[model samples]
Target: MGVPTLVCAPHRLLRRIEAGYLDNPYHNAVHAADVLQTLHVIVHGARLHVHYLDPLGLLAAYLAANHHCAAAFELLTRHTELDVLEPLSTADKAALRKLVIELVLATDMKQHFSTLTHFNTVHQLASTKSFAAAGSSGEGLLKSAPGGRLANVQQEFKEALYADGGPDGAAFASGGPDAAAAAPAPLDDSERLLSLQVALKVADLGHLAEQMEVHKRWLAALEAEFFLQGDLERQMGLPISPLFDREKQGVSKSQVGFFEFVALPLANALSSAFPGAQPLMECLTSNYRHWRRAEREAAAAAAQQQASAAAATAAIN
Candidate 1:
């Protein structure tokens, strides 16, 4: 009834996220929700005919949605605010709570290296085999997703993943755990890692796939968070994001850049690997254009604000 785990599980996880995150811009619960929603879209698409439906995938999606929740609970338990979550239990809830936590930890940016490598070397092969069998059966290949820019996106996905060196090796390395470890990395163009990266990246940008109004609300929330985080990071002497403020480096950009650069390439690859999934690729491709245009317009707005501030100062002087 109602996903059984929805009752207590969310509350517990939120506790951990709220505590640990204390409200960061990019990695909060909203971002987690976006990832899960993105995964849902991919899963339900007619193309990419995944067989065996990756139990891990479903588990991971649930975990992503609740990652912030886990952090919230961590904060609560640490502070002995345990009573705050008393109303959420149901046995199934407890089990899912545990399950969700494990999966969430596994999804951490810190584990991306080993996680991504394993995905390329192992999970990719296994999943491919599984999909192949499903296609070989009478169902025949995926029926092609309903209309969308699935093909365009798939092509870009393939280019990024299947590239000779592997997507701007430097770009991939700069993300997640590998950031502090290495220097001038080689492009990996490894098919496996690309696929996983694509999955995570799409999840990061899933907010765009939402209904326009819902999507706008998410953008507002994210913008508010970015400003908050930027101010806090400046006060704390931390890095600022380029997307938010190129002049200061407190994580100025969200993963939207990743979507613009990476999504289409990875989507293309997926389409090639599984011909029936063309529609997903197309949707992703079109999505990229939208984000790129939005970025340009946003930059203009910021410039206008700066200009107005300058004019006010000049008048005062």
Candidate 2:
């Protein structure tokens, strides 16, 4: 915030970031902008400014939202686009760079379980402290100690993250049985830093919390990107990932799975942590229902086609 002389730094950096993103339907500058806007809404709506975050925290959150694809961007552009840091003092630049990198990397889907586990542990500890302070009577919890109530709400998110075999469960792991074997290592800084990391990760997937039309457009863009990947995979003679295989993967079906495994859990966790952001959970639920209905319709159409084929064969016989 102090780097007044470098007012255009963000714009220049965003330009570089935008150029780095591939010309895919999704994972491009527009999606980045969408996430940034959503992050602003969540931060303001939840009144995070009034509670846990400081200036640095807010800056990191905004950077994380806009540059969640920094790793991919770097690979595509062969540059880090960190020139914006030039405006700050050397020490401050280094610290901010580190924070930005950590926040961006936390958005990787592979880290989902580990990140949730760490956040859950922090939430649990905070809840324990708040409950002890509240004692047997939870009567004056919010009225007496607002911070304690906030902590409890944050801790309650852990339940949603791990509910009904969430991202951590055997079903979602790509590493086979060995994946679930390693427990999440305890995070050292179970404080503001951890909360910010969790918040940024949730914000990166903020599309799932948007209104129906916005969510549908983003989903279509993502599906188109996936199809493009499938095309590349075919050209390279490599096996395409299931969701990326346009021939085999139905957008509605794949989206339903994505919502179940990733979006819903994240939205629920964030909503629990920030009660004011509960509307995000509602949006996620609505999206899920929409996708589920689409999936059913797709399945019904396939079944009808198969029945027609069977009847034609019977008539020929």
Candidate 3:
């Protein structure tokens, strides 16, 4: 944790970042701060700190948390007075920038499934290797006490995630007796970076795991933002995106869909890897239940209104 002092004051840098965010109901400065705090909780509460991530990796994760957009990076680089990373060596600075950019880009929903798949694969491979090393098969391990098997796999997964080299590092280093001729060992940074990406993605959607009231507030803000965008598109004679047209989208029903299709899967995967993060999963589950109930109530109310309208028409007839 021996990260060097920043060239600029932390408060000043934060102020600049906040200013750069748009004045949207959602996806604004407050959302960025929320993500930063959520990522911090995941890193520390999930025991990722005990892993092999160096200060640079941690720095990248924090920076990427607030700077998920390309424009945010431009803002940091454009203003010399706000260049908090100016104190680092050239190589370190470049490496940090690259990692931050990758992590930020990884937050895009387009990468969601692939990123989750990669994370699952990493842990799966680690568990398989661990089982092999113990001279046992995964099926045999599964037959053992659930608690014992989970603990063993969790420990091995943590080690694999933090390993400084790939699982095939030995093969990469030994080129058939010509060690020097072997390809250079792959960087373990990929593993660490993937973990950071997962943390950021989870944090980007952190509001979904908040208590019901807080989650409701965030959902309202997000819907407001989407409706605003839809309004703009309408004014411009452009097509409104799905879930953006306020008139057509049912808020509670949409929330239920999002929780089922997007939020739960990622949160569940993370909790599976780090049991310490089960609270996030638990919150999400409770919130999902709330939305499902809300959706049902809304549907019932609509049906009642329709029935009342039909009764009134029949009376007039």
Model 3, span 25-108: residue lDDT tens: 988889889888887776665656666357677666446656545665677778889777777888887888788888888899
Instruction: Please report how far candidate 1 places residue 161 from its true position, in Å.
Output: 16
Compose the digit string of candidate 1's lDDT tens values, residues 1-317.
22222224545544455445445545675566557655655444422214412333343343456555555445546755443334445564465455455445545656644543443343334345554544432111112211232334334444533333322111221222211221111134343223434455445555554444555566677666667756677788888654454344322244356554344434443444444334444444444445556677899999999999999999999
Lowest-sum lDDT 10-residue window in model 3:
167-176
Top-scoring candidate (lDDT): 3
Candidate 3 Cα errors over 4 Å, as ranges:
68-70, 129-187, 250-252, 300-317
How many steric overlaps are in each model, in order? 59, 0, 0
Clashing residue pairs found in predicted model 2 = none
Candidate lDDT values, in order: 0.45, 0.59, 0.67
Clashes of 2: 0
TM-score of 3: 0.75
Runs off by more than 4 Å, candidate 1: 1-31, 46-50, 54-61, 68-201, 211-217, 239-241, 244-257, 270-277, 291-317
After the best TM-score superposition of candidate 1, give how far the Cα of residue 60 lies from its true spot, in angstroms: 5.8
TM-score of candidate 2 relative to the true fold = 0.69
Worst 10 residues of 1 by lDDT: 138-147
Cα-lDDT of candidate 3: 0.67
Task: Give the winner by TM-score.
Answer: 3
Query: What TM-score, over all chains together, does every model reach?
Result: 0.45, 0.69, 0.75
